[model samples]
Target: MESTTADWVSETRFGKWFLSTETWYREVLSVALREMREIAGPSMPPIRRLLDVGCGQGRSFELLAERFRPREIVAVDIDPLMVRIARDTAGRCAVPVTVMQGSVKKLDLADGSVDAIVCHQLIHHCSQQAQVLSELFRVLAPGGMLLLGESCEEFIDTWSVRWFFRHPPGVQHSADEYVRMVRDAGFGVAPRDIRTSTPWWSLWEFGILRRYGLVRSPLPVTELLLLARKS
Candidate 1:
């Protein structure tokens, strides 16, 4: 089946190469996995059903399964190849994950069916980001949490990423822009719920600054993770 969208990581040779490797699979995704458990902390409801959007290769399967221990995990990805890999890998996990090919703009699940959403590093790739945000709100059960992780254009336009990755034009946004978009979608967000981060890898090509001790303690933050709740 032809995809309704373009510029996905699965479409390009480099994208496939990067995603199929251990470096990008675990190490790259681990930065956001650290926030997953925190998003599913004691404050939130006992997560029963989970959805991992953009769950390529099911790299986050073990982490989400281990942390939330949800009864079921529904993994969704637009790429058919990724969906296949995810389905194949889902069995390795103790938690049951139903892998499906679907776009974030239009999820196939029922309204308010999921207890939590692990939307890591996926939104910037989407052109219809507002529709995707609204869809997240629609699928999440009341009081459900969304662990939204994305890097800003500053990070995306970097030499390392610009060369290897191809994102949808006019889709990238700053941390505050993403926060506002999430808030505008009717999800409740607080100062504490939102988080801004600067991953070392985001500035990997700019290591000369760090090496020269020119980079300050807090390097330029290029990533944003907002934990929004369906109110």
Candidate 2:
């Protein structure tokens, strides 16, 4: 996709704030991470290879590395500054993390190479969400998990809500739409709620979708967490 220098800077500013402030980052990311772990389950095998798309500053991968003990973690982002900061953070944390400066829609990795792929709040920024999803599916191994967390499209049902989303310039998708897309890409959907310690700004949902044909009851809430696996 075509991106201007300003777009890169805007993304960088957002990433900087997230990495610099513990409160803002933890408040949201912590919930997402917890939900992901729950879906993964404690008995799940150790993740040998993992990818964090739009890995801004590599904070999420850092958390995952500590928990899953993945042998190798690749973090990719479009912004060079974000990639640099992520590399530095990995160095400081002593986590074996590899940061790449590139777009998720066009990954440099080989097909079916990763066991798990995690993307947090980065889909809203992409102009080609479908293409990005396709690329994600292509790179994922059969039975590999794809966890995505982002703003709920239901937030735009009203004009006031739509205004808020537009001001921030995020591409929102309804929970149902997300599930449908994942299913179309050959995944099973897992149901879960996305909650946070903070109420007002809480935008969290946890759903697990697998490549298998397992299906769960639909959620009634507006926001959701989606988990899908590639078959």
Candidate 2 TM-score over all chains jointly: 0.76
Provide the TM-score for each candidate, comma-separated: 0.90, 0.76
The 10 consecutive residues of candidate 1 with the worst lDDT sum are 1-10
TM-score of 1: 0.90
Model 1 misplacement above 4 A: 1-11, 204-208, 214-218
- Looking at model 1, residue 64 earns an lDDT score of 83
lDDT tens per residue, model 1, 63-160: 88877778999999988878888898999999888998878888999999999999988988888888899999999999898988898987887777
Lowest lDDT 10-residue stretch of candidate 2: 202-211
Across 1-231, the per-residue lDDT of candidate 2 in tens digits comes to: 223542332433443564567774676677777787777776766677889998877777667877667788888998777788788877855457788888787899999999998887776666567777889999988888888776565443446544333223444566667667667776666665233121234322223231132534443345456678776
